[model samples]
Target: MQWIEIVVLALIQGLTEFLPVSSSAHLLLVPLFTDWPDQGLAFDIAVHFGSLLAVIFYFRDDLIKLTRAWVGSIVGSGMNQEARLGWAIIWATVPVGIAGLLAKGIIETSMRSGYFMGYSLIMFGLLLGYADWRYQRKFSANPASANSDEYHLSKTQIAVIGFSQALALIPGTSRSGITITAALLMGVNREASARFSFLLSIPVIVLATMLQSVELVAEPLPVGWGKLLAATAISALSAYLCIRVFLALIRRIGMQPFVLYRLLLGAYLLYCFY
Candidate 1:
């Protein structure tokens, strides 16, 4: 790949991976529009691994605390909030994992159509916008009433969000977007909803990378080693910065900005493909 293609695609993967804007949709559409050849699974794995590391690095402190608490609880130590949250994250990842396994063939074969991607982009965008508006209105009436504890997701909420995550298998139903939208519609605060959505990503990315790695074990090396390294570095840096900025931005603006972006992007894609 040319340097320009490397940079653009890597940046797109990094920037959209965490946001509710659907990284998969952007990745899919870019080559479609630009007439570039598919990046192939090897390069896809490399960039994804980069984004995975970015999320893990950014949340290192929280992961450490959650890990220690979770491990301690397993050993019969007193359970705490972080420990419970840790287990909740594990429980919540199950639905998506199962869905990925069961639907992998169908999703890969039939769900990559641009028409479906466009529809999901528009429909999910409107739903997300409505959820954000509803949340703001409901919270504004008694903004001072919520304590920090209310942000932590209940068991039922986690299950609901987990189930919703399976929708991400569709071409434009972004994993982060669907998960965050579900959390918000279910009454999670913006920051907490984003936090959980990102946390849920860790296991999913790891599983995906491992699965791809198995396929790559016998394949010829993809691209030059040097190019792969450069792409990985770019992916990591871009993704880390994207996560930081997105989290900070959501605190200030809620999800409306991203929702608007999705709406415009969907409409443009529909025009192009439909």
Candidate 2:
């Protein structure tokens, strides 16, 4: 791949990976817009692997606590808040894992059409907007309402959010967007929802990378490793920056901007595709 192509695709993958915007949508649209060659599954895996690193490093401290707590709970040690939270992340990832496995073939073929992207973008975007609106109203009525001790998600609520994440299997549905929308719909505070969405991404991304790694192993070797490494580094940096800025903005802005952006993007896709 060319330098510019590598840079643009890497940045796009990294930047949108954490955002409510769907990175898969952006990637699929790239060739449509620019007529670039298929970056291939190997490149996709590399860039996503970079994003995994970004999330891991960004949440290193939290991961340590969660890991320790989770391990403790496994050996009959008393489960604490962190341990329970750890388990919550695990449970939340299961639905998507299974869905992705069952639907992977169909998703990569028939589901790749722009028609699917347009509808999913608009539908899920509206859902996200509604959730944010409701969240704002509740927050206005009772400041720190979501912060109340009783506001944490129950098991049923977690299950609901987990199942909703499977919707992100569609190209434009956006894993983070769907998960955050689920959190907001369940009355989770914006910051907390964003945090949980990011946490939930760990296992999902790891699983995706593992699957792609198997494919990468079977493909040609040593041909593009240098370019792949460079792209991975770029993706990591971009993802890290996006996570930091998104967390900061989400706390204050409450996702209105993203909702608007999604609506506009969805509309454009509909016009272009249909």
Candidate 3:
């Protein structure tokens, strides 16, 4: 890939990965508008790995605490808030993992059309907007409780969010978007929901990267390592900044902007394709 393609794709991947906006939807538009060649599997893996790095690094401190607490509970130290949350993350990832394995082929083949993606973008955008609206209305009367604690979520709530994440297998549904929508629907506050969504991403990204790595190993495509490294660095820096800024501003801005953007983009796509 050219330097321009490398930079643009990397930045897009990083910026959209954690946002409610669908990164896959945005990336699909690249080749449609430009004459750029497909950003082969190697490059795809590199950028995602960079995103994985950003989330992991940003949550390093929390991960350390969670890891220790989780191990402690396993060895008979008993459960605490951190350990309990650790287990919740694990259980929450299971549904998406199974769904990906079972339905990935069908999703990639049947759901790659612009019409399908456009419909998904619009439909899910509305769902996200509704979820955000519900959250705001329920908490507007209680400003002090606007940032409710997520650790107190019931098992049913976690399972609902987890199962909802499987819907993200559709090209434009967006894993982060669906998970956040589910959390908001379950009455989680914006900040708490965003935090849990980001934490939940750690395992999901790892799983995606591993699956892609296996494919890359089997095909063994010739790749430009230098370009891949550059993509990784660019993606990592942008993703890290995105996480910091999003966490800082989500409580104030809410999800309306992203929802509106998705709607407009989806409409444009439908106009062009259907």
Candidate 4:
């Protein structure tokens, strides 16, 4: 990819990664529409790493507190709220990690193919819209006034959300979208679901990026390190800003706008590709 293409792709990756709009779908569709060369495994790994850094930086203090609390709990001290949250995140990551490992090849072969991109877009868009509708109805009927602590998810709920995340292997099924949908279905409030979803993403993204890096190292691409570094830097900066903006928007307008956007994007993809 040219430098300009790299910048555009990185920006797209950063923005969509946290925006509930499916970063994978945008990456695939943007390249298709723009006539850019496929950003192969190396580029993908770089972008993921960039977003990983963004999240880490954004939540540094919370992460430190959680880690310390978790360690203390392990040594027989009473766990604090942050420590319990840390444990919940750990529990929620398991299903996705295992599913990603087992289905890695299958997902790569099937969903990542350009042929399936349009289908994924339409299908997952409808699913997200349905989920949002259900969540809105339930919330309107009996609003949740409880805080995160009060609605702390059980292990079963975590497992279910984690398993739902596996569906996000498809290009249009945003990881946050699917997991938040699961959490909402399980009765967690929207903001709490979103918060936990963001926290849960740290480990999963880190491990997946590491695995992708290993694959890239096994067979170095034609691109040089300078290009990789530039791409990653741009992506990281963009992702950081994206996450901030998304969180603000969620607090203000809720997720309905995102649901509408997904549906329209999906329809556009179907029209263009099918």
Model 3 score (lDDT): 0.91
TM-score of each: 0.95, 0.96, 0.97, 0.91
lDDT of candidate model 4 versus the reference? 0.78
lDDT of 4 at 239: 89
Clashes of 3: 0
Q: Model 1: per-residue lDDT, tens digit, 111-201?
A: 8877778899989989899988887887889784233232367888888988998888888878989988898888888888888899899
lDDT of 3 by residue, 1-274 (tens): 8899999999999999999888998998897789999998999999999999999999999999999999999999999989988998999999999999999999989999888889999999999999999888888877766655567777988999899999999988888999999999988888888889999999999999999999999985687999999999999999999999999999889999999999998887788789
Please report the TM-score between candidate 2 and the true structure: 0.96
* Each prediction's number of clashing residue pairs: 0, 0, 0, 0
Looking at model 2, the pairs that clash are none
> Which model scores highest in lDDT?
3
Clash pairs for candidate 4: none
List the candidates ranked by TM-score, beginning with the highest.
Answer: 3, 2, 1, 4
lDDT assessment of candidate 2: 0.88
Question: In model 4, what is the error at residue 236, expressed in angstroms?
Answer: 1.4
For model 3, the run of ten residues with the poorest summed lDDT = 143-152
| Poorly placed runs, candidate 2 (over 4 Å) | 148-151
- Candidate 3: misplaced stretches above 4 Å? 144-147
Could you tell which candidate, 3 or 4, scores higher by TM-score?
3
